[model samples]
Target chain A: MGLVGNVCVVGLGLIGGSVLRAAAGAGHSVWGTTASAADASAAAADGFDVGTDAAAALRRAAERDALVVLAVPLPSVGDVLRLVTEHAPGCRLTDVVSVKEPVAEAVRRFAPSARYVGGHPMAGTSASGWAAGSAGLFADAAWVVAAEDGGDPSVLREVTALALDCGAHVVPATAAEHDAAVARISHLPHVLAAVLAAVGADGGPLALALAAGSFGDGTRVAGSRVELVRAMCEGNRSALLDAVDDALGRLGAARGSLASTGSLGKTLEAGHAGRLALTEQRAAARTPLRIDLTAPDAMAALRALGSRGGRITALDGAVALAETT
Target chain B: MGLVGNVCVVGLGLIGGSVLRAAAGAGHSVWGTTASAADASAAAADGFDVGTDAAAALRRAAERDALVVLAVPLPSVGDVLRLVTEHAPGCRLTDVVSVKEPVAEAVRRFAPSARYVGGHPMAGTSASGWAAGSAGLFADAAWVVAAEDGGDPSVLREVTALALDCGAHVVPATAAEHDAAVARISHLPHVLAAVLAAVGADGGPLALALAAGSFGDGTRVAGSRVELVRAMCEGNRSALLDAVDDALGRLGAARGSLASTGSLGKTLEAGHAGRLALTEQRAAARTPLRIDLTAPDAMAALRALGSRGGRITALDGAVALAETT
Candidate 1:
């Protein structure tokens, strides 16, 4: 219940570096760790207190009241949790891994004494490494917090405040819910884009030559780091499998509707409605993010957050934050 | 064949305005047509000779030894072709519609004047309108020329040269090939994106809010002009239906592969190979295009063609061209 005064981030990659920057900018003493001397030295040079040794970094972080965030990949999260529990056993810990059910289960099994919560900072670029990190990267992004059955409310509150400090909106969900939601939103889309890129490959030389902004934009993430996507797919296989099946079923329905002799307008309308809803939700969430502003003027502009009495917290040198009082 | 020193573009929308800019930048005198007086005035102000009436534009175009480029929507292409043949029957004509088979069939049925050739610029953005048009838009894009059975080579050459002048690589495919290729590459992707958006919508607000770069990038084009997509789906129903079925079958295979204790690495490898092939093809084809250097480092960079055998044809302000010898 102590004030969330210090934040510790493990991994020091894009997501970790971003959290470090956002937390540091929010007046917290931020601590970071990496697997190698090279990454630690690189992060330290960027004004973060990162150390070469993970155990040493954890010991330094445990000196103060800190909220430890495991920002590693899904498969590695469990091992990191075990290490943190053995090294800095008293500090509260959470993870920024994308998939949660397995990670939560691992935390429950390995780190019984520590207050461990599962989190996914639903923000990142395809770019990785400390060099690719940005200060305001997590601004206006979603942070999904999955609470286990016996999870500590004080630890969850500290995690919530940390996410909010990084200009993220906090959403509470179960570990299974979090996994299913991300499977529908993130992992399935990556697989679909991967297959889409495959189709363009068949056109031989001309297809790539013929690709314009649409193709490039559509397949932008198809070139994502293969190892990361692989880990994610393997960790959340069942949920992702269900999502793919659901997606195929929807495609089948559209194909059937369009092929029917009935009014094609209904099928098109359904698609239009679905697109509008998705875009509306994205805009609602993205109004606070600092993404590129390259869209044409004809698109919708950001509107004010109405009637919500939540206190708005600001980070220095970050994007806009207007709180409703 | 007479000299095609000038070209008239009817309907100053995305496709038409882009043609005028490309044609003009490629050393052809360009005229434009607009139904509204305001658009005509804007076109004239923008250095194009504008005609308020379609027939008048075609006649004026013929008087100046120009080819008429029809750049209207799919539903209206037939009417414009009929009007062009009735008014300026001697002028060679071409059209830039996305779905070629239906338009080609319509041209055959409505405008049997062998001067009308079916053309499609395989380049575009999610953007539309005159302001969105750029001189370099078509540079290094693909131009598909579908030759009618026993059609005039002179007309085909004019369209091909126009395509080349726009700095596009010319790909000659039958209307059937064009339709099938686009169905697999273009229409199918749109349908899949729409389906993903639908799935995201069904997951409720929290899931939609968690949509990151992958979801946005994958479904970016789904937010494009709904009417345009609808028209494309309706016009190319048969090909699109087959493509949807094919995509569903692919997804089914992936689901099976993942469900079984088989190699997830192979599934990942298939995606990797698909993306790598497309990337390699783009790199090879991009050797002859005047791509901008300001794009993100992750995006396809436009390097000077001097290293290759290709040479810059033009570089004035925003318009740049690299042509292969």
Candidate 2:
């Protein structure tokens, strides 16, 4: 394992913390910042190198030529970018935000030199907080990387490398495409669950009791952190609104079919087709892996090789090799 | 365990076979019939006294002064009623059909002599067929009994006792009420799932693959037995249609709030209220339990108390207790 030299992970929450853990696990000198000293100390206790603040974290991360990963909420991503501009002026940076458009805009406005690539790890649960952090949470998950303005090839490669080190499949797309895809697949389903739960809630107690498996399963996500979903809906209003409308229209059409005694076979066929199509597209290719080898562990491993003055391979990227004798 | 007096369960599929297992387990002389000799033989081997010929099974059931349970589908319930009239003329009868109105009509049109009470056991899974049968399937489930005209009180009590022995809570209501209740709670959810699945299917392959936990859960029942759900839609068309319309209108309201950037908090508040309302309703008083005491186990227990020469203690119309010298 080679320590990642000066890796900066913002927002010390579950996703960011997991990234910190994975980077540390892979021998990366992880630098992390949080909204509070408590979270910073917590990350430090968990083996992350806690910086004085977000700006300090960025500066120290930059001095070490670290990769900065913005892992804040969609709404708070802009503020973090502002801090990045005031601090890490020349560092190659990327984000782990779920929605991409706003972060891309913020990066364009504030941190123009920070090679900003958008990243979304399609992983989560209904629970939140640092206690929910796990190093292997993102394993085998699809890590979507969105490149804006033909963004720095090195930054894209570096983030893709980071994702691979954490055992994720990397998929590249544009910011607009990512937002639209998530709106249709993720945002819409949450709205539908909430709506369905509301409907079943009014069905009377006996009906609810006899709900069996269907209602419970369907309403599971409705019980998710409402504030987080609300933030997503608000931050990505237009996209989510359109998604909701599209979902309702589809539901309306199906209701009409059921009402008219029309063929239900057609309805089921459409669902089957949709599910198969999504599967085929994702099975396109395997993800890539790279690492930084100019770190402590790789240098040590290099020294042990009884070799001199050569580059060592990082699991995520091809960082310049350390001289070994 | 003494065998229950002759019990006829029409239709040896999941629900019917399940009833057969529970009754037979309780020592009832349970007899069941299926569409094919294969099903009957399978049921027979599984401990039910099943016959390939429905007519003969019905006649034998009737000759034993048994309670016959109509366990066929909605579309076939009417034809089975006619068969009941010709073969099981003297048997007291009930049904285990999901919907109630059509069968209520069928019961009125045929099998006039038998004290026919409509029964709906609100228990099942996505699975069907005799192999899916389980003795404890009805445990803690609500068994809805619809009171019909000319249905004897004593027969209703007997059926309630059976529901208890099978580990079900009894809920009494009229056929129309039962139809309306199920339409809203059960049938509406199926339509919603179908609509959801249809949207994903039509959204192209990539869009569908991105459907995660919520979508899968919400649309799980969409892939249910197509014919059965379609028949439910058609047989209880008016109620189901009304429920679908009502659910759509509610969903439209939710969408409108999001579209207009109106109070989402208000819409969510309404949903919260509805859910609480359902929770309160289920905590109310429970319906009484009734079933055939001549069920084998009950009969054995009864005979063990000493056939005819016993000191009678209490007789609560449908049930009685006695002490043997």
Candidate 3:
């Protein structure tokens, strides 16, 4: 209900398309833009006011007090930023890019006048294009929001509200922390799938025919497009590489101790415990309260909320909240 | 329809319970034996004739012209084989163990007089125990069967017939071939999941909370009980270690190529192609014809069955068949 203005989503990819569908259904005035004329026309056919010119769309959206979302690939963020600065100087900007630090850096360098926030919704189906997206794509998914240094608080609030409007659970994080975390969880796993499948290629026809369940599930993400893999790996290069090293080190230790059944069993038992923790984390839910507070008043706000069982989560530099039972 | 008379399923674990359910539904008088008294009682509660004494069950089943399936853990295969030889002498025996070569070796060493055929039903749910099984668990799943050296041809045919009666896609493979194939597809994925989860243990709360569909699915098998993991790794030690080396080599190559965008993209692309091939393999199916032909008559069998567009699949060295479109 806090998101009162018009919305502009500047890509017709899966994430952008899903946001458009959800925002429009939530009664926000939604506008969409894509590089392809066919996609723009398709969006128009679907009853959204869509175009291929992102800047022009953002400019018109700015006049209506819109939140302009940059949903293109990572490399295109700088270009989208430049266009927004040139055409829609004072508008609020956010993005759906997977990696955040680089986008935040770009926002600081190119879009000085615009209010900018970097965001990523950890949600997608196997399919990529707009046709594969639906209004339910972001429902119950973790959506991270990262504010650029000295960015407007109102802009971050509006972006978080937009994520909430799409039925996502907002998880506020610094750009640096987000990049590092995803490098471990998302990026590394994609590479792991590729590694698993690469090995499976040597297995011949029998292996291919017998690979069911876990094999299919484990290697599912290796089927991701090259562009996406490139963007994710190159975008979070150091962290991704570090995570890979951590994995190989663990596996190497297991390999060294493989002949020792006791050691191998211990390592596997630890993994079972780790998987249990992951399952528990996914199942746990918290009711969140978005409250305005300065650093001095944050503890007081948290204390007023509860001390028995809850966590303090920062929304931005100036606001904090409680995630509670 | 080829499976006649009584059936006995030893162990009453996931595979054994499912076999009992399916065989009983297929109009066979089924008996079940489990090491755990609770499991035997539970199977009996499910309307099955069940007991804790596996040897007694097999001995009784042997007198009734039964097809006896050993569905115990991998290490117990040799002991189960010995029991079959001692108590159920000359009975038709098969197993649902994951590893085949070891089971075949055990049959030769301990159950030389028992008519033994090694089998593995490529079907299971995440849950174990008799409580988690259904009558339709093996429906349309790959069921690999391997014959012991100098085993009766009639025994192999009867086991394959039982697999078909359980609504499985019968895929006959040698013990050596089956062990190698499963080491790559099934066993390796389990260890891969374990390795991935081991690395994930080093990641903090943020990474775990944000992990969604792919991470969960990729590591699902890591949650398997440690006993099973130990049994699998130990029983198929050599092939599993080889698969691990192959995967490590592939991942090391990717890590080495991380600095080269072109190389990284190509590796990911190959993985994509591999995954597509796997998907196609899973989706592709055909009805098969069991054609009896000697080694000398193989070419004639192939010629007569040919050009009609089907694959030639060997059946236990004594016969060959066509898996037709």
Winning candidate number (lDDT): 3
Best by DockQ: 3
lDDT of each: 0.69, 0.67, 0.76
Q: Model 2, B1-325: lDDT tens per residue?
A: 1224557888988899899889877777777888867778888786667877888878887778888988888778878878888987767889988888888788878767778777888888768888888999998787776554445666766676677667775565567767776776677767667666666554444345345676777777776777767766567777776677777777777677777773355555555455455545445443332333435344333323321112223335545433332
Interface RMSD to the true structure, each candidate: 4.6, 10.0, 4.0
Clashing residue pairs, backbone N/CA/C < 3 A, model 3: none
> Per-residue CA lDDT of candidate 1, range B46-165, in tens?
877776788888878767867888888887887887787787767787888888888777877777763777788877776777777777888777777764455555666677678877
Error of 3 at B180 (Å): 1.2
Q: Please, what is the TM-score per model?
A: 0.78, 0.82, 0.87
True contacts kept of each: 0.45, 0.37, 0.54
Give the CAPRI rating of model 2: acceptable
Question: What does DockQ give for each predicted structure?
Answer: 0.30, 0.25, 0.43
Model 2 DockQ (Cα-based) = 0.25
Those runs of model 3 whose alpha carbons end farther than 4 Å from true positions after fitting are A1-3, A27-32, A61-65, A129-132, A147-151, A285-290, A293-325, B1-3, B29-32, B45-47, B58-66, B147-149, B260-263, B285-288, B293-325
Best by TM-score: 3
lDDT tens readout by residue for model 3, A103-132: 888987888777777789999876776777
Worst 10-residue lDDT window for candidate 2 chain A reads A305-314
